[model samples]
Target: MAATPHPAHRFLTMKAAGVTLAALVIILFAGLRFVHLEADFPPGVSGSGDLYTDEGAYSSAAVRWVTTGQWRLEGDFNPAVNLPVYPLIQAVTFKALGLSLGHARLTSVILYLLLMAAVWALARRWAGPVTALIALLVMAVNFNAFAFSRLALLEVPMTLFVVLGLLAAARGGATGTVLAAAAFLLALLTKTAAGFALPVILLVLLWRPEPLTRRLAQAGLFCALTGLGLLAYYFVLVRGHLPDYQTYFMTNVLLRTQGGLWDLGRALVRIIWYGRQFDPVLYPLALLGAAGVLVVGGKLRRHPLFWISVVWIAAYLATLATQNYAPARFYLVLAAPVGLLLGLMIEHLARSGRRGAAGLLAGVVILALAVSGGRAVDYLRHPQYSWASMMRELHGLVRQDGRENPVILGHFANSLSLGTGLLSLNDHYTWKSSLPARLERYRPDYYVTLGGIEAPIRSVLERYGTVEPVRTWDVFHNYYTGEPVALYRLTRKSPLEASRP
Candidate 1:
């Protein structure tokens, strides 16, 4: 016969066990991040390719800061692409620890660790310690989150700040409104996605009519402070080199809303479908969870936080749906709310004695973990996996050429350009407006072009120099070949005497 333990003893032991499990999961996640820290220039495959163009731009800006003590946001004389906050953060990292890819990636690792803490806090508030542990584990093994966190990108910081904002807002205490406002401002400055969260927060405050006036006042003060900070930072520190707000706002914000209803519908459908790419096994369960949230209408409607999260997810999805180009990555903000709903469903099922459903849910999560974890491990072990290899090869070529003053001209070439530390002329996919003159001015020692754009590059190079085959690299797997697809590079040299000098 087994001895029965006291209720208090069992409770204490379970709590200790949960803490230990959470610690182990966090440690494992950190270990995975550190293990792949220096295997490549940008730390991960997606981080080294076109997927991380923004990261590459920031990296180049950081490099300039390190070498010249200048923090100019303009890249290749294109001021429109500048986003100063992230680049400034990267510059500080580079300054603190010399200009190395690993150092740049470390900034992301730090942010990811902080994000885990934020997620843990949020989950604990809503679902207790066990579910929080599960949520952290899910985040740790989530392929998209893991991949992005290891890159020098703005998304991780933005996600972290957003989680902070949500955690602060959900506190349900006297300081909750103030803390939430501060966190929201931080998130807004980090990324434009933060703006979409405003409606949800406001709606939640309205639902909670008791603290309506107080919360609104706090939110107003926070927004004002944030605006003042932005104005001061731009006019005073940046010396009035404020970006073309109208153009950026119109193009990236207002004009982007021109997409038709059908276009938005298609994008939403694709987003919902593709969001489950990494975890197909859990797809049905996630849908069920979403349905469950709707089914528990009365309970959810009364809960301000629950409605806030739902509204945030819906508004974000709508915003993404309206975008001209929709990628699975755009729905990342949807993950947090999805996770919350999934956690709620799991708890509901567990409480209802539907142990089989809970087991099934756990199995799906485990399957997702296995598949994503395997992919991550493979990526870590094989840095030369597709686009990553091409970028690495290009970087090596530039380093070997011993040409510190080299310039490159191409379309969609920011990643390779920045990785190789070469001056980029332009990233336009189409040839236009004095292309020859632009090439001559940059006076590039090498002009590289990807395969798809080879014809245009050949025509452009004919006027300046001869095109030569430098190297080839594979891009994701191809269906026919049953292997990764290959991209060819064509390089050219300057023809003019002034360019040669």
Candidate 2:
């Protein structure tokens, strides 16, 4: 018979197991994100075409900055649409890697890796190594988190800074407080959605057991430093466009307060549905963890990290539910805490000697990985979802028609611009009212429409020029459903062209 292990030896063995688990989580994250990055695309397709439309805009702006030395969108210096820090980082990536979609997306992947590391540190500090490992696993396999890691969006990086801020604030000292403030500032500048972290940060600072006067002073100092940083950012980057910035802020804020009771409830349901889609098993696990946190309030009430997690989730939900619209990516802020909460729940199960329950929890982690990882693989393999071939065809047509770096207008403008190596004037989803005025101002040689145009916009295009049918591409949503989006090239009349001149 094998000798029974010493108590100290058992503890060391457990420690080794925990460390191995953490390393496996990191490996899973890296593999799921990096593997098949180049899969499911047409041969020689431009990397920029892999991005979602808004993602294309961000990448395009970075590409423009690389070529034109302006960080904003070419011809539009508005900071309202594109923040500086993300674009600057993307520009640096393009500078180093020569401007491919893969290169730009690598920046997001790197940010996500750092984000995972920061989340691990925070979870390890608040909970323990096992909880930290669980937290990392939950986040690594979440579909929404996994999806964002592959795009060059602001949410992942913003969440990174917010987690760093929370981790720093948990340390409770003058230096920690200062670092927390700096991280918070970076989060805000990265994306305004991070403002939700502010109330939670202040609350954590207040809960510190220092003298009331000292606590107030520290909290005030943190807020002051954050405000000063914002002021500096505003003066340097957004001063000339301050009104635009205010409008953007007010529009988003007003949206939060616009809807009625039913709307709010519907929004709440949608958030739950989104969470389910992202991680069906872990979403419920996090909810159970949250309930566990409340049930064991006596032990947790004095813990600042506990309050921070609760407040963080509450603030994000409150803000998100109030919004007129919330995309799934907006919930990236909630993922880290949800992951932490799930970790806490699993730890609770272990402490209570529920080995079977803990084993079930481990099974749920594998389910999350299988569902989300499979989806990621499918998404990467099907280039039809991205329309890369369509963009390539459009670029070919533009070259064959003898247009020399001509400007293209309309909704598919970014892809057309990137694919053809030409200038494109597009505003993603908006700018409908300004379409005619934009056409009059820019006099783009080609106006392309993809995914069909509204009757009114079609009328305007017909009035301005000739509508010639271009190739139609079938975009597949899943194995069962597919739809054809016809591309049309609208050539401006010489008379209309002269009118602009």
Best by lDDT: 2
User: Candidate 2 on 398-488: residue-level lDDT in tens?
Assistant: 7888865567766556644444456766643433565677676766776555456668887877767777777766542311223355666
Off by over 4 Å in 1: 1-19, 38-49, 73-82, 170-182, 203-210, 222-258, 298-301, 348-360, 378-396, 399-404, 417-419, 429-440, 452-458, 464-466, 475-501
The C-alpha stretches of model 2 lying farther than 4 A from their native spots are: 1-15, 18-22, 38-51, 73-82, 171-174, 242-257, 260-266, 296-302, 352-357, 370-386, 415-421, 427-430, 476-485, 496-501
The CA lDDT at 501 in model 1 is 36
TM-score of each: 0.79, 0.85
lDDT of 1 by residue, 269-337 (tens): 766666564346554466666667677664433444456556776777666666655444454555566
Winning model by TM-score: 2
In candidate 1, position 442 carries an lDDT of: 60
